[model samples]
Target: MKNYLNSTMIKITLMIVLCMSAFAFNDSKVSAKDEAIDLRAKAAILIDADSGKILYEKNANKAYGIASMSKMMTEYILLDKIKAGEISWDDQYNVSKYAYKISHDTELSNVALREDGVYSVKELYEAMAIYSANAATIALTEVMAGSEKNFLPLMNKKAEELGLKNYTFYNATGLNNKQLKGMQPKGTPEDGENEMPAKYVAKLAYQLVKEHPDMLETASINKKAFAKGTDDEIMMTNWNYMVKGGIYEYKGVDGLKTGSTDFAGQCVTITAKQGDLRVIAVVMDAKEENGDSTYKARFDAAKTLLDYGFNNFKMQEVMPAGYTFKNNKTIAVKDGQKKEVAIEASKAISFIANKNTTYKPKLVLDKKEITAPVKKGTVVGHVEIQGDGYGYIMPVKDQATVVTTDDVQSKGWFVKALGGIGDFFANVGHSIF
Candidate 1:
């Protein structure tokens, strides 16, 4: 029985070792090189989500009217509500007279709610997020909480929480509204271009990608239709044709929202990823003069941003201190209780380059020694990394898992008795979170 049990344990341990080894090997192979692409937009941005780096920009700081992009913010605020337990996916609601009226008043995109039966929040969220159904969005606002009047406050408050400095929410559907009499020009220049809320809308959409990327599965979907069930019935199609059928090559091309109004022209917040890198592309009110299709300009600018990010960036592994990129020495342990522990990184490491620079990275670990009851992945010291344009550090950790130590290499007399106090507090933060 002892021999059988010993063989089983060794097999299980080796399997775990192999799995971890695969993940570690994969981490070291990240590499990329940027290739030029075309863009056509008056004001656009391709932003790197991890480092907040701007990969490409055309009047990126300039703000203009964004049509349906506003829906992204509205969807974000709604998702926030869902996450915070303020609402549930299956929550039911009725479209009030006012909401129904607003939805039907003009040619704005709508899901066309009827008074027959209650509709679940899930159905409505799909209409707005996947289909950009404006009417459905208004109906949700009206039925879910009370009124768009009440919901707009919630939207503003969320904007503040996301640290959006220049965004604002006007309505659930984001149709350009003439400010009710007394409101100032929102500091937007009175260009008579019906100053659309582009920046605020893009920021809200950015929050969606930044805070909850899982929604992309739903957002990136192209089109779907509904059959008449007892509760509700509606048909919808994705307005962003590029997403449904066009050739966008970026990997993990998830979702966002798209918008267009004759006045608003073309606008979108597009999300895509390559490796660990994810990006958000935003464009508002393009002139459309550069191409026959306004969407061509937006997609072009979006492709420009995506290509710059994927082709130009790479991820590197900065080995822990007292360890090597290849492997670390069998570290000492306490009380003969030697077990394997991986070293910890001092910080999340990254480097960025653009058309102007080429770079190389070097690793620097702080200490060459370690002490234990060194739990696997316990930080003992640090290592630094320097690149052509930046520098980073890798922290050392307890390698060989440790236990109550009598072995002096694992923990010397002084360390066993006194040194673990700081570690206790650090461990508290890690364990609690």
Candidate 2:
């Protein structure tokens, strides 16, 4: 557990901050070549969850019709409320007249809410996530926040906090009735109202999966009904067809959500884990020339990126903070120091490599030398490692403890107390001589 915590890590982790410090070194821009996949979406983004690296993207930062992916924010706000004990999973939720009416009025997805039956907050999350049950989302949003009016504010605030510069929220179910001007149920966009839009709904979806991985256990289930012993009778189904059953070798495909609207076409956000590496793919507005929504394109894109990551990258846990990371001179105590003192790595560094690339990282210690009565986990030195493909920057620590170099030559704490006695003896000795 001797993990190194570096001062650099404590600072805003500018992934390329170190690289920028010395010279304007341009990274070998990878072309990201892979012709096996085609995306029909107007916008899409494939991201490496850990590094926020864009693996693939069509319009990575353009805002478009997000459709039901907006429910992910709904779920986040709901889950945040639950975690804070503002609501319980089992709290009874009766279908509000507003929720029940959406099933018949809106041209949207729903489980056909039962107005009289009670559902727990947890059941609605599954319906909203796995099934994209629009009614479930609206009801959950209203109940959790007392109204959609208040929840929408939190949604935008949270998006801004996450650095999502291009997202806004108006409704919980993602139906921009605003787009359906002069239509019956699909209301027109209000005179000045706007909707939440993100360049990559997949990025946010991936984040949710990582933050609450336990949600995957619930998300992986393809079908379910409300709590059995309760008064609910309707059954629910998953929307992601591949998650329902697929022809590909999707071994650890665990999460997330699916969405679709006439404008958004077939949208999907997929998350999977292979060992320690995780990839999330978001596809929006997917449709083909044959009038079929390109669900396979989304599926293939996810598998492609996951395969790419798993095939190329491997994680290497660096040496512990106290161990010698390289042959560089270790930081040691200076003033009264004897040989050395304790120094520990204050950070942990992991490296990612391609198949042909080797994982030989170089070391970058903070300063040239150190003197000690140094405390454990103190910042001492650093390590930087690089190969043709992947590289990592880290810190180092002294393996052992040290004391002052010369006891009499110093006036440290203990020495000061004993200095008076030594000075008196010196005077007496001089007189005798």
Candidate 3:
């Protein structure tokens, strides 16, 4: 009997050891996965383009030089003007001395423009979008705001209107003012360049892609000859090599922007689509293991972010339609046949998250109690999602409308009057007490 008891004890100990081993193995796997996604950039952000859910971030709020990526603001402003009928693609612009000089500077990206050349808005926009041509960008600013100096105010005003809280725009071309050869905007530092946090950069890219998807047509062009069959024609190549037929071609990568400068290093704001899943990634000032910035480092960081998003997370319905909040299923109704009315989420809320993620629904009522005679489907407030720490890229998109589940009739007039009298006496009694 003693030998049998000792054997049983030994088996139990072995079982516990095996269970502990399994748990430790699982924990190590998770830790390795978390460590594998490190980004080699000064700032980075990954967001679900469709739902505006942030997947990952690193130093996302710290401001850094954006270099040519600043042209995205120029693109947004131009697109806004075209949408409002304030300008047309056919509108013609005369190259200014600033634009003319910049175009002739061989060190910069530009299409040479003859002094007497008249160019249409479409041509210059294509040059700016496809080639990151500084001269073409400046000419468009001249067309829109009369000069790049005047366009500075427009950029800041639009940034404010778009809820971009941290940003500074010094030029339309995204060129360092020192490179402008004393032509930098008045009252601005001569060596200044455009700067913004990674979050704002992602926001600007999000707004641009959402509002003006048509811009992708120009931005996606891999290579095009400017002024074909003319003496001044030059081959304009897209700086975003991730586009189709480029060195680092990525699937579903059609539009966006790239930038590089001594101060900014290498930066890219990339967008990609797979099936119904769309994601945007921004990598700013990417560097090598040795701490030297390189063009490939930006693309590498962006690729890692994009892969992490597409592989780890998927868009799923976190909260179902008609879902009821557990703690607040019904709301009080004043003078109704029933004392309360049932409420539910009017629509489903979906977002990108991992399989292990969980969400809780929170109901926020418009008022403490709704008036009687409420109609079914009447909006009461909104249902918000409380996730497992991860927040949304756009918090407003994570809400669903909350509505009354059924109609409630008003109480009989005599009953309401009697209840009112009883309530008054009760109040008086409480006050006397």
Per TM-score, the best of the predicted structures is 3
Question: What stretches of model 3 exceed 4 Å from their correct place?
Answer: 1-36, 331-341, 365-381, 388-395, 407-433
- Residues 325-417 of candidate 3: C-alpha lDDT, one tens digit per residue: 888899899989998999999888876766545567888889979888999998989977765344655656578889999999999999999
Candidate 3: worst-modelled 10 consecutive residues by lDDT = 27-36
If candidate 1 were superposed on the true structure by all CA atoms, what would the RMSD be? Answer: 17.2
Badly placed stretches (over 4 Å) of model 2 are 1-41, 47-58, 115-117, 178-188, 191-203, 226-234, 244-249, 287-292, 317-348, 356-433
Model 1 agreement with the true structure over 122-232: per-residue lDDT tens digits? 888888887777667776776545766676777667767766654445665656554222221244322322233333444555557777877877776766664356344
Clashes of 1: 17
The lDDT values for all models are 0.57, 0.60, 0.87
lDDT of 3: 0.87
Per-model TM-score, in order, reads 0.61, 0.65, 0.84
Over 233-255, each residue of candidate 2 has an lDDT whose tens digit, in order, gives 55666666556354443766766
Kindly indicate the candidate among 1 and 2 with the higher TM-score.
2
